[model samples]
Target: MIDEVMFMRHGRTAFNLQRRLQGQIDIPLDIVGQWQVDMSGFTLAQRFYWAKVSNIARHPDRLSQPSDPPIRRSDITEYEQAPASRRRMVVVSSDLFRAQQTAHAFADPLGLDVTLDSRLRERDFGQWEGMSREEINERYPEGYASWKAHEGGEAAYGVESRPDLGKRGSSTIRSYCDDPQYMDEPTTLFVVSHGSWIAATIGNLMGLPDSQLDNLTGMRNAFWSRMEPQYTSNSVLFHLTEYDKGPDVADAVDWENGPAYLRNPDMPMWKPLI
Candidate 1:
């Protein structure tokens, strides 16, 4: 029962810095990107560690012995010493170099291996793969205009359509969750993929209409979104619980108190950041 899926966008690349369409170009992360990965990775690992502790604290009956002492700071070290299987988490990534690099940042600290899936690759930009948005607009005014209007004009230029990209991305994620190996446990899947692909997949998972797709904006580099399954009578649907979260937000959390602190009934619930 894959409990949750964390879809993370890879770190910035040279092409990202230059505002060019990388598509499937296999770009590597730049210096800033590496730093982003390092910080976010550390924060991610810390959050996971604390989340495990929180679960134990919430369900003490699950402890090996009823007389076991309350969770303490030393539990962190104990967790690190535990076998990887005890973590109940898996890291997955697009086969692209950038995505794989980002995935490793989270996997290495968590002592998990990354499972690569080529289907998670970024949408093929085709003729505009290496071009900047400005160049595309300048070179193919009509197509660019049509694309901006959400009229599927880019298909004429050999670009992958949004529907096609969404299908590919959503199906790839579904396959992983449906795998027999992951179906029985409360596992968390960390999927590192591309910006466009992530957005499209999320939109599909949430069953967003084409006219409503634009309501969900693109994700920034090194940021992530968390989704949990919401089982309906007909099928299971993923609900977007968090979006565009990153190290900055994680750093702001009150780690000493844990995530539950944020759910205090007296605490004012804030709207999601733009």
Candidate 2:
């Protein structure tokens, strides 16, 4: 059974810094984006190790007693040395360059390969692909207003509808869960994608209305959300557990408008959560 799915947004890009719509454009990560990926990747690796240890500790026959010693790094090391088949976490990413760059960071630490899926790409922004918010507002004021209102103006501009993007993302994830190779294993699937896609997909999976989804904040670069599957007799439902989690320092500031601490190469990487 695929128990957990994590959706991660790719690190910042030149277009992201310039506040331009990248859409399906093949943008590479900037220097700062590379730094963000390195930090996030290390933290994610720690989380994977900790989760594996916790699972073993919670095993029916091996439950830890109240007096048991605290989990140590040695314990995690031991778990890491276990057979590969016993640790079945799969990393999947959008085939776009930025997403693939972010995916490799986390995958490399776990000695896993990243599986690319085109369906996970960012929403097509059409003619507005290279435009910044300011440019869009200046060139297509009415369409911009309509888009802000979540009306149908975006259709005229050839942008992918939010609902369609959600369906594409959600269905892509569902297909992986239903695959026979991973169906019987307690697999953890990591999907490295884009901000809008992640948000839309989460809203769709949770069966939330567009109005409710509008209230949810967009995920920052290199941040991730986690969902766990709840299996019923006939269907599977995913429940959101964590949202927009990343390095500890990032928790306090909105990177989009805040100071450029993440851009500093000297900034210390956060210690592992585990």
Candidate 3:
């Protein structure tokens, strides 16, 4: 009974290329983003035997249906159980286009159904939803420090506070992990969501301090971040209670593992400051 959570950052969005704080911005993934995610999916799927798609299907009742199909598999023809890999699961993004599209790449291979949930949506940026950090600083400098500090009392015009992001977004993930529909399966869990939401989710779960939280940025689209949960007598029972962060092989995680486009499987080197 190994509890594993794979937090995948969404693929490259227009906001990502601009070096802006996407913060709940609903931008589509670029071509490179698609490639990145697909690569992650392939690599991770190979490592595991079966994959559970994040695109969980819900009946009108909103309860996740067990009979719900998976979005991807080990084999393209019929998703056979591979001896070398473990079972994998894909959690489709609630963001219609990005999530669905990302799910399609994996689902089409295994013929699994993609599960969708609004709760997994990126952090609602509030007033800052679509604007970049530079724009925020140019327009309102006073609010910037509060934002950097993650002080939620005051807001940057209409953006969501760090506190609110932690409260709602983190709560949603906790509920998801507890919910049988998302967890309860033995396969690996792959979550697809916005950058801010991903950071907030991990930060809140780990109780990351404000300084640590502020240092994070969004996950690169389609890249998988590693996390593991250990069994402890005192910890919550029958579930993945609190996971550990692993080095993000895809270079996409709660924090940037290293500079992008620097990965060379053959060379295998990690250096700061790309």
Candidate 4:
């Protein structure tokens, strides 16, 4: 029975800035990306006490009522002074550079080490790897249209199929849930991964419908979603603290002269709803 799980999408990168398909190219985070992660770390440090302190330390008075509020440090300096009082935090990152960097931002603040997992890598884009939407449309018009229409299934050229990608996402998530260490108690696991993989994983865990699958894309760079596990006999269930629905919106029209969602879609509907 895992307690809380947080899925963090890596910060922006050069490819992201250009609106290009990075796939697994191992792009590093840009300056803005780094700043975004720093703020996230700062925010987390404020809310909960780090795990360095025992669970007992978090609840000094064992008899404290459930209505008792969490014991949070008044200042950052005070929080850092008592290393023993810090809460325990485990960071897991995709092998990709962007994700690793984002994980580092959170791990460094808590004085924790990051565990890299290849299983968390992004969906391989294959031939569409470094191309932007326009380029992909121009070069592989037929494949692009088919991919969008199906939401996913046919790989762009020789890339990984949507069904396979979704399965990989589901399996990776299940692996963490089934791990004895994470299930030992109420643990918080910060999984730093790609947007596509995150979306697919959430959809897989919740068994979302095809039409609703695209709703998961509202996860902006460096943002995160909190999830909790609900175990059942036949399957593992999860509940998201929050998920963004509706089409992606931009402040202004994109260079494509259309809404961001219409211009560049991001959905992982490899198979029709069952």
**Residue ranges of candidate 1 with Cα displaced over 4 Å:** 50-87, 232-234, 249-274
RMSD over all Cα atoms, model 4: 10.0
lDDT of 3 by residue, 70-142 (tens): 7532232222233312333545565646666666565555445567877777666666656667787777777
Per-candidate TM vs. native? 0.77, 0.81, 0.64, 0.73
For model 1, what is the C-alpha lDDT against the true structure? Answer: 0.78
Ranked candidates (lDDT, high to low): 2, 1, 4, 3
Which portions of model 4 miss their true places by more than 4 Å?
52-88, 151-156, 210-212, 244-274
lDDT of each: 0.78, 0.80, 0.55, 0.69
Best by TM-score: 2
The digit string of per-residue lDDT tens for model 2 on 1-274 reads 7889999999978888777899999999977688777778888888786444534433423333355467433344344455533646778999999999999988876556688999999999999999988899999999999998888597898999888888888898888877888876688889999999999899888888866666577898999999998878877799999999988646665544334654465543322123
Give a tens-digit lDDT track for model 1, residues 1-274: 6879999998877787677899999999876567667677888988876444433444444345434567442344444444532447778899999999999887776555698989989999999998988899999999999988998889998899877888898888788777888766577888999999999999989898866665678997788899997656666789999998887654765322225533456533322233
* Candidate closest to the true structure, highest lDDT: 2
The local lDDT score (0 to 100) that residue 73 gets in candidate 3 is 29
Model 4 TM-score (2 dp): 0.73
lDDT of 4: 0.69
Backbone atom clashes (below 3 Å) for every candidate? 1, 0, 38, 9
Where's the lowest-lDDT run of ten residues in candidate 1? 254-263
RMSD of 1: 10.5
